[model samples]
Target: MAETAVAAVLAELAALEDPKVRAVNEKQGNDHGVNLTKLRALAKQLKTQPELARELWATGESAARLLSTLICRPKAFERDELDAMLRQARTPKVHDWLLTNVVKKNPHAEELRLAWLADADPVVASAGWALTADRVAKKPEGLDLPGLLDVIEAEMKHAPDRLQWEMNSCLAQMGITHPEHRARALAIGERLEVLKDYPTPPNCTSPYAPVWINEMVRRQAAE
Candidate 1:
């Protein structure tokens, strides 16, 4: 019965697959692509079905795994299971989704963040940094903002692409949320010069830390 239900979900996912999106996903290093809207709709239908989610995740298809991230119960994941999933994340999209939908909500989020931040795997470190970024964006009351800025200043230039991106995100969040750190964050941004040359689309915010900090500060002032 469980197998049948899992097959039905997979069949729905397959039916919703878009070749164009799949091609783009492939270029972006994802192994599969289904319409994300459709996938989310299916996940909504299967909400809280951790057993079914496990089955979908076990199939190892990218879309199914993406759906599983939504349907799986955060509390159902053991640290080891989450660790294994982080280790096996093969693409940035999957890793990002897992961090946002699964790991961030999990009971083990703090533990995982601390452990994975020191992990040798770039993907794991990326997820850890992402989790830290999320925390910085929200309840950053007790976090060592100065120490964080120090680390970003020291390591961001030599970090891997994924880790660098998350570090930049964390830096931006810190600058936006903590007024005392704003000048220091901008200074660090200026010093690191990461993504300084990356192009921004018209009317879009630049990702360079100083520019990003300025834009966010502007928005905050307006609000």
Candidate 2:
């Protein structure tokens, strides 16, 4: 059933040259969100047309998700091919997609770990940390605790209020999800005083504001 749906969607996509417009239409059909059900179906039919799937994803608003779905499909994408496509994506959404799909969950997880850690963009950097935390949850042994520490510290130094706040959430996630790492995270959080340095803005979840900051602290402390 999923294969049939994917084939039908691909056939429809092939008949049209502009997938961006199709993407808009698809989004509208799905109440202004990525059609994940359709994408998951497409992922099931990943063989024999990986490149075309990648092309369609490149033009879709839900490209990130599709890319992630594709990455999760075993044997669908070559390592170098995936890396090249990720590098070619210039949009922040695409970058985020790559972070979620390829960098974070790639079969070649170690390679992506190093690459994303070195990325200069805050969006990329934050996503990198997020992925690191996620992967650590799955496989805690031999994890790069030092690298994770470096990223949160860097976030405090270079990231904006919003990202700084996100770092707090990520840390709390790490703390709760991986208890062994909790102490290290709390130690860093206490000494950094990043929340004090940068205040949260109106209508923003900045790390400096009393409400969000306190919430983050509480979450971190939660048993």
| Best-matching candidate per lDDT | 1
Name the regions of candidate 1 deviating beyond 4 angstroms: none
TM values, all candidates: 0.94, 0.54
Which parts of model 2 are misplaced by more than 4 Å?
1-49, 58-74, 90-97, 101-105, 144-147, 160-169, 183-223
Candidate 2 C-alpha lDDT tens digits along 1-223: 2455445555643443355655665543321233445555555656435444554555443443343445444355666765565555544455555656555545775665556556776554555555665666566578766676676766564576434655665665566566566677667777776665554457765543233434655766794
By summed lDDT, which 10 consecutive residues of candidate 1 come out lowest?
139-148
lDDT of 1 by residue, 109-220 (tens): 9999999889898767888888888899897767787888888889999998889999999998888888888899888889889999987889999999889989989988
Q: What is the Cα-based lDDT of residue 113 in candidate 1?
A: 90
> At residue 114, what lDDT does model 1 achieve?
90
**lDDT (C-alpha) at residue 47 in model 1:** 71
Residue 122 displacement in candidate 1 (angstroms): 1.6
The TM-score, computed over Cα atoms with residue i paired to residue i, of candidate 1 is: 0.94
